[model samples]
Target chain A: MQYPEAIAKLIESYSKLPGIGRKSATRLAFYTLGMSDDDVKNFARSLSASKSDLTFCRICGFITSKDDDPCVICSDESRDQSKIFVVENSQDEMAIENTHDYHGLYHVLNGVLSPMEGRGPEDINITSLITRLSDHSEVKEVIIGLDASTEGEATTLYLARLIRPSGIKVTRLARGLSVGTNVDYADQLTLTQAVNGRTEI
Target chain B: MQYPEAIAKLIESYSKLPGIGRKSATRLAFYTLGMSDDDVKNFARSLSASKSDLTFCRICGFITSKDDDPCVICSDESRDQSKIFVVENSQDEMAIENTHDYHGLYHVLNGVLSPMEGRGPEDINITSLITRLSDHSEVKEVIIGLDASTEGEATTLYLARLIRPSGIKVTRLARGLSVGTNVDYADQLTLTQAVNGRTEI
Candidate 1:
């Protein structure tokens, strides 16, 4: 009445991921059974290699190969060193980098400061940002590109207040109604932020 | 702008499974990076072991560990060998077993006949079922437990016709309005089936 031991173990592991529940995990495990042997081997190898072959950049906290310490963004001297676009994760850094709009370097905070979850400033990569900033006097501005949630807002404020005393410029990513989003359908918070942060053309 | 090579490979592997898109894959891959070394190792080991440590039951076509051929259900002699529950996958077999309502053995077809998709009798486990039926005179009846979809219905009817000639009784799972479902909200097809299959209470 139970799944075979190997299958049950795989299902349990798959369910450990975010958003994947018991049903989804079961479905995924069965699907894996149907996959070609080569694909399964590759998938298994990739899972192992991700842990063995990858490490976080010490300065920026971005993911990189184990051999590379500072990551490509940090090692590149051609990029702007004066501004550090801080985000919650490397995925956000990639999203910004994909746009080809910002020429500055990035700093990954790994997570937001959520007091509701007992995640304080010390829990995330905030102190490293301060250290990186103080160590490099050339770094002029810190862009607090955190989420628009309450936690993000609070973290941005905390970082801004902490950095401004150093006489270095501190700002946050602008909040507004998203592009292509209908004004009538936009949430109250989004509309309020758009109105409050209105700019002249 | 792309993810680090190892991370990208892991994300690609994650997205290969059902229902996981690029964004979800990226999130899962990053989460894997955050998991402990031991947990990641276990996940990788499970993935490899699923393929290496398991095999299909030769008789029932259900998943079982490599050393066990006919699976637990087929090998059990105390269960009712007079009836067989036929299903499309091992997951379906597990679902029926979880209900604890049916004590009969199960036969997994692995897939249903889909003529629209060019799948015919030869593609699925139909021939094996026929062989098993003729091999065992004790199997007096076969209960078709496939899904209510078009392919399932087709396979059920096809198999019923194929085995009924040999004087073997073939029955199908009932089709009616599900328990606790709002009848008024049920679709027209379901209503029609419910009306057609009504039994005097």
Candidate 2:
């Protein structure tokens, strides 16, 4: 039986995901066939809804369901507003949250500095970070919690230099994490250690 | 800055794809930010299109874009209608087609018989296949071109036994495929030899 063009197209789209080859994509496409029309519609709706419902927090750049300008992290009175742990992305924020070691808020750079990939400090939200730091007088500590990769190191150095004039104590995650590993892939114990052993730049 | 709720939701949805994990999903989700609104809409449309447009052909059970009763392979007049190469799914049909080795048609069983997975002969299109054999007097050969896995072997045995009374030749792909390997993952040369040297059961 020939699948309709739309089914084939969806299979192709599923195949584009990492590790999902053509065969698996077809399986997933067929799985969708078993789904109720309403369920399938809901799944498709969720795909677009996620893109439209979520927004980045303006103050710390973390992803949140709300668009309240400051987000929960920035607005929460309990969170340590004086210290900001800078991360490469929201996944890192999730990883750090899983560890439950850090009480301070987070700042997602969105990406690291990768010259080979043509990604510079300006390519991400470094300017916005600097602006946030300059605008907020309460923030005293800026911890660079980027990955331990070459790009992450470059980004760390760049951000440290950029934020030093603001008189904030710039620090980074400790050397416990292996080189070339992203914070998101790190285990809970390793992440906790990295957070606990943060050092001054 | 935190991504909008819609963007975060899209990233979460992307993460559900096989092998995407979280970080890659985020990257893909954010990459969509660079895409034009039309492109994003098109991506979503293609996804739903694949689901809504395709249907399984009633005769050969191969997936096709045509809405006509039987798929192109089932309706074609010039092809060797006497020989039918059975496969586990439509992707397997494509894999065999990529080699340009077989001109005969295909019968997609949808899946192999795996009792451990609670998949019996009735679970797949075995009944339809029996009906097709009894209904069509022209079919001369039934080729068991399934995977080389345990389940594939079980399905092949079940099919061979069931079709023995049909007075048609029942054959399987030669042992060119490694045991426990899927036909879809096999190299072209191996699969070609398997198809070319198929022996009667």
Candidate 3:
């Protein structure tokens, strides 16, 4: 009374994604079967391309084509070379990029430090950021734009301590109430940070 | 800024899955990128294998290996040849098979009648079901195990009308308040059905 071997394998693959369980995986696997032959092939191609065709930037650790090792951000002379915006993931970089608020170059940390899981600086893209800074004397500042989670804080503190010795200015992203979040619904820690970091209009 | 071409393609591919929006697709695509090369290759292999290495059963319309045309259940000599349990999907068939209460072959309709979606009798696996019934003289009963939704009811009614002329007994799954459902929380229609179908136990 088991699903066909191919379908079961597909279901297991789908289950590996975040937020997908066995039931959801079954739903996804069946739906995949209903896709056109071209679509199925294309989906498979995209999956392989995401892994095989893309590589981390040698300079900034962001995702780029296999041929573009240093990535466009690292190579772009028009961007602000004096500042590097460091993030835990490329999605955060995209979030900031979409806003058109920052023009500096980027450094993807890939992941945050999590001692609970035994993930340390060596496990993420931290080494490359240090190397990039050391190799580029024009860089004046490193802006840590990691998430506001405990692990993010730990990574930021570690990175700050690591970079502060070189006399290059280092700053972490501001922690306060998120935009559009109601004060009454805000958590205690956020409210305290909001009060402590209030700026005059 | 747009994501790199490969990552963007992966996101679009992931977005095609059920219940997965652009945000969730982005998360899944990035997660796939983080997977080991071997795991990613296996995931891609499963996606392609689900399409290439498997096909629908010629008789029951259930999924099977490419080489097994009629599928295991349809070809099984041990099962009850007098009964055919009709279901909307293989998942429904698996749900029934898990209970070990039924010992009949299954005919997967692939989809139920959904007029709003422009799906008709021809759009589903209905024609094959009729053909299977005509070819097999031993099938005396067809238990319609479709969902109890409007579309399911429509399909059941359509199939029942179509097969009634052949002198075969056409039955449907009973509708009532589900097991473990609280009486007070049951919907009006379920309560009505439960009352109307109540029997001495």
Q: Best to worst by lDDT, what's the order?
A: 1, 3, 2
Ranking of all predicted structures according to DockQ, beginning with the best and ending with the worst: 1, 3, 2
Q: Pick the candidate with the highest TM-score.
A: 1
Q: Which candidate, 2 or 3, would have the higher DockQ against the true structure?
A: 3
Cα RMSD for predicted model 2? 6.4
| Cα-based lDDT at residue B133, candidate 3 | 90
In model 3 chain B, the worst 10-residue window by lDDT is: B67-76
Candidate 2 chain A lDDT trough over 10 residues, lowest sum: A42-51
What docking grade does candidate 1 earn? high
TM-score, per-candidate, Cα-based? 0.97, 0.79, 0.94
In model 1, where do residues sit more than 4 Å from their true spots? none
Q: Tens digit of lDDT per residue, candidate 2, span B13-83?
A: 66665566777788777666545555556557766665567677888777766466588777888888788
Q: How large a fraction of the reference contact set does each model reproduce?
A: 0.83, 0.44, 0.82
Interface RMSD values, listed in order for every candidate: 0.9, 4.2, 0.9
lDDT of 3 by residue, A50-143 (tens): 9888988878878888987778877888999999999988889889889998999999988899999999889999888888889899999999
Question: If you score just chain A, what TM-score does every candidate get?
Answer: 0.96, 0.81, 0.94
Name the regions of candidate 3 deviating beyond 4 angstroms. none
